[model samples]
Target: MTDDAPNSSTPPGLLPAGLMDLLPPEAEREAVLVETLMAAFAGHGYERVKPPLLEFEDSLLAGSGAAVAEQTFRLMDPVSQRMMGLRADTTPQVARIAATRLGLQPRPLRLCYAGQVLRVRGTQLAPERQLPQTGIELIGSDAPAADAEVALVAAAALAAAGVPSVSLDITLPTMAPALLEAAEVPPALRQRLARALDRKDAASVAALSGEAGPLAAALPVLLAAAGPADGALAALAGVELPPAARAIADNAAAVIAAIRARAPGLRITLDPVEFRGFRYHVGVAFTLYGPGTTGELARGGRYMSLNEEPATGMSLYPDAVLRAAPAPAPRPRVFVPAGTPEAALQALRAQGFATVAALSAADSPKGLRCSHRLVDGRAVPISKEG
Candidate 1:
């Protein structure tokens, strides 16, 4: 066969990379998951907000937007004759809403959002360039309680979505950067240290920062202490850090303590030097993972909204959340034969059955996967053999 010839099993209408069409009940499951999460957020007083898919490039790329600018897809707006962008992340849009539209609202605005985001590229772990994210943004508060509250609320939402035995990993992305700055490390060495931390390599961190004096001595300890939360916090407490860096560590400890108080059963871990996906987070950040899952199920942390107001929140990946949830109970489907009384069909629907009306004489209810069929003025279950 020629190189371009399609294989026998390869069907037509192939989708582009990082995109897939959801068919059947899977699509319905996703919608239900989103609604369940939104309801959980609402229970915690986070009002729902929807931002448009496209916005002027300048507004969309401002502040935290700069961190995700590369992933955003840009287009030209015909009316304004200006560049526009399809948002790669909804957090930035929510931040914009807080800063501009909801400017006059009370302090500590609690806002939640659910929407699809389009990215230009995808990572190995998450290949879908199109993603559905549902999250909350707690703006204008930097207290440790705010941090802890968001974490627990996220966990609560996951539980509501039926994700079991969830574990949370909290990371301090700002810790290493602050220590490097305090040590007066140059730009080149700082980049090297960051790369080492990404690999969880303590030896490289020590070697790179060895000449920076006291800060160099503590780098190895910090990297080594990244595991269980209690032990990691104990190790961190002994390290003599600069005043500013120490405060950040203290905030993280407080948040962890608060979470423990609220959810003693929840598993928690700490990583002081993790800096992979949190480019804009300024304080305690977290990622949620579950057993049998390939990548992080959700991620959130403290960051400046609009690069001005302090904000803390988390976003759950709908696809991951659905994967982690128990499979939904099968839907109740019934088939109404042609010439069946309209009242009968209405009664079936009222009785919690999903009715499928017969369009032709040859259409069998069994062929449609219907669990029951209306026959002779009565609804009866379909038999397996017959």
Candidate 2:
């Protein structure tokens, strides 16, 4: 081999940044993982639904979906000439489906979906603009038990995907906003408190809420209470919350109780101050993380469906789920020699071996990287002597 470096010119057809093509086994494994999650959701009574990748911009970005408006990719439809948007999230599309085609269906509709979504941007934690997501929506119920059901189903799906060491972080997106409203915190100070809480900065929270009264004073205390479920609940109990905020706390407690009943062994944490990544979540929300995974494995929360019915659901990122899954064993590949009879090769394949037939008469079963070779009328192991 020459010591000179190879040509480094840009290829004629390279993909855009933050987009990539999945190759071979990795792509196959991701497909398997998505199916596993869908099966898990189906087991919990969630029916699968498919929505088009693009839709009218107005409806797609309406209601709670407005939160993701900036992330949507917009275009002019060739037929309608109306502005259309490539979905950045599928939950809204599912909601639209529920409101229209499935509107006549009975209450408590359990729907699940698996598809690819395109976003205009990507965060540092998840650098891929295009992603595969699988999720379930529990629509038409506002009960706290609905929240717990969604959470439990999400955990079960992750477990089915071979990611068992997951930690679920539960939060109330409305907690800080409710507290600020209850405490009559001025608009300026509320913004400061929001920023500080988003960063989990206790000192700044305290500094901003110094003279805002006892309810406001609880801001720092709540910030400190972001940890294990038991401790966080105990800490929350001591904080004097206004009636609206107190109601939220009660709903969370109920959701926790229901989750404990369903999945007692799951690791759960509470972060009442975590307000990020839950733009449209109106109630209790959660994010799942594998033991050593950098970003969240999945996220879900309570929201309204079609701006009419109460709904709760969760969405899981296949890329992260696959990253956290156990490595799959290689498939058994059997290589057939060039002169091997077609009947013998068929026999090998019928026995569940992945047979690779030689293309030319000079081709032998050597160095093909297959696990076994067709010898005589049987697939036999390739010995060192061969």
Candidate 3:
């Protein structure tokens, strides 16, 4: 082969779309961010749990898991000859554990988990197929207080991860459906209206015929009502909603009130007609955003766990969190000359120095990207010009 020709035997560094390696400081930073968030959850009495990366297709896709079925990757199991699936989300598995193995634990189970999730594809906003998730699940509670607690804890965890100015946008996923059901709109019109509302297309919604009765009129108002929490609540109160939709609004108000009482300074907003991306949330749900972040930093809401247990939780995307979080300060690395005492290395490590021992006299500390060098068993700063 000519020297200019491509080498057939050489492997390329190309990774599959929506997937890439996390190298150096970034990988370490993500690990630290996960631990920091987990510690915050633990502080709030959320014990840690680890779920398997794979499970039987039936069990993995049961109940709420059905929401992500399209994103799950499935394969036939060799031993059982049954279909198995890699987890696309950890929340369902956590719920499964709460309903089965830990069913008898307590009335309100608090659990936190951190792990990697593999999805078949990615969304327009989040185009990464492999992502790290750190989150907490508060199960067996239907109280609005449970919702508030989860939101607050998630905010606190994000704060601990060094994300500043985090804001919560609360949404009533069921309100629109409840309104439509009460108005008894035709199926075809209902689907169209729903699509319009999901897209937040006010012009399209207004263009729809007013023949749907109260629902047709109420939807545009609800869409307009989305704004800062206080004002939106006032607008919702003015709307003459059906009994079921009214109840949902009331529940949302209560949850928002609880959150405000606990975290008075938290930035809160409301969207009464947001029915997209929350497939299984039966009650109030919320999306968290950090200043300068592209997409949601975390999201959670009330849902029915396995065996129909009431549950609420939040899942933080570490990739997004790392983006919003302040850049981590690089750790000091110290180079130790050859034949350095093992005890000296241990001492440096005890002081939080990342020691890089020299393999030979020719190995330069600067070449190894070390910030310091060990001399007489002490870490001495290395000149940048060296």
Candidate 4:
């Protein structure tokens, strides 16, 4: 066949560049993973909540912190003059619910949701911006128990996702903030230090903090203290924690201690220099990653008393979790008719095989490499070399 360059004449369906179609097996695998995570959160008393994927820009930005706002996909509302946006993050929504609607219901609210978010940001890594996110937000309760519950739920979620050997990168959001404030670091200098600390670039951390004043003097030592959970906390002692920072540290330690005591074998690392990731992460922000990876598999943190109209919560990046998920075994194939999936399913059931609607006719047996197909518009028979 002669090579023909693609042009605009190609159907719009064929032009979906940053989008993907998940086949039955992949979709089923994702469904299973989401289900498993939901169960884990539910077990810990986090009730399920479904926040609207589409919201008025005002509502979405109601209490969303600064950094999170940068990630939203802004658009104009056709029905009204108001600008609108797809929620880039759901934690603020969760926070609003807890502070307003759920205020009368309970002092502490645990809610989780699975939703699709469209990121306008260029997907340099994956070339796909829209993805599913299943996350939980812990609101109302500032107690260490709440943090522990979140940690436990996160670990269980990873296990549910079939991730092997999850190593937690635990950090105290208050640490860096606390250090900057106590050291009386200049606003300009603190910014540079934050970046260096995130990259774990010791030279940069020193260089930036070195000129900030007395605050920069011991900054290197404190940052170097980052390691195992307990060790990091110990190193923090020399850092001079104000009451707020001390409280943040105490809460984190309690959460970590409980997780270790309960699970015993789970590995947790502490990075005290870790700054707040999402602008909403006020107290303790943490991320979980497996060995040999630089990106976070799952991340969340505490943001207590965010706004008067809302409260505390966390948002799990389901897309990240999905990315980190091990490829599951192929789902058992069930072929069905493209025209009449019902008739085909009825026939399949009669033949003793459970069946579902066929997603595409391209899977017909006679079609290109179509290993699975509905024979005679019904009946499911997985071929094998018997």
Task: Assess each prediction's global lDDT (C-alpha) against the native.
Answer: 0.88, 0.87, 0.91, 0.69
Q: Report the Cα lDDT for residue 116, model 3.
A: 96
Error of 2 at 205 (Å): 0.5
Reference-based TM-score of each model: 0.94, 0.92, 0.95, 0.80
Error of 1 at 201 (Å): 1.7
lDDT at 154, model 1 = 89
| Per-residue lDDT of candidate 3, residues 1-386 (tens digit) | 89998776645787888999999999999999999999999999999999999999999999999999999999999999999999999999999999999999977999999999999999897789999999999999999999999999999999898876899999999988898888888899888988888889998777762767855577888788899999889988998988898899899999999999999999999999897664999999989999964568999899999999999999999999888888978999999888888999999999999999888778888889999999777999998777
Candidate 1 is scored at a TM of 0.94
- Which segments of candidate 4 are over 4 A away from where they belong? 1-11, 14-17, 242-244, 291-295, 305-314, 322-326, 334-386
Give me the candidate number with maximum lDDT.
Answer: 3
- Candidate 2 stretches greater than 4 Å from native: 1-10, 337-351, 362-369, 383-386
lDDT of 1 by residue, 244-275 (tens): 78998899899998899899999999988777
Off by over 4 Å in 1: 1-12, 376-378
Candidate 4: Cα lDDT at 272: 70
Question: Candidate 1 lDDT (Cα, whole model)?
Answer: 0.88
Ranked candidates (TM-score, high to low): 3, 1, 2, 4
Please give, for residues 179-228, the per-residue lDDT of candidate 4 as tens digits.
67877887878888888888889998888876876655656876898888
lDDT of 2: 0.87
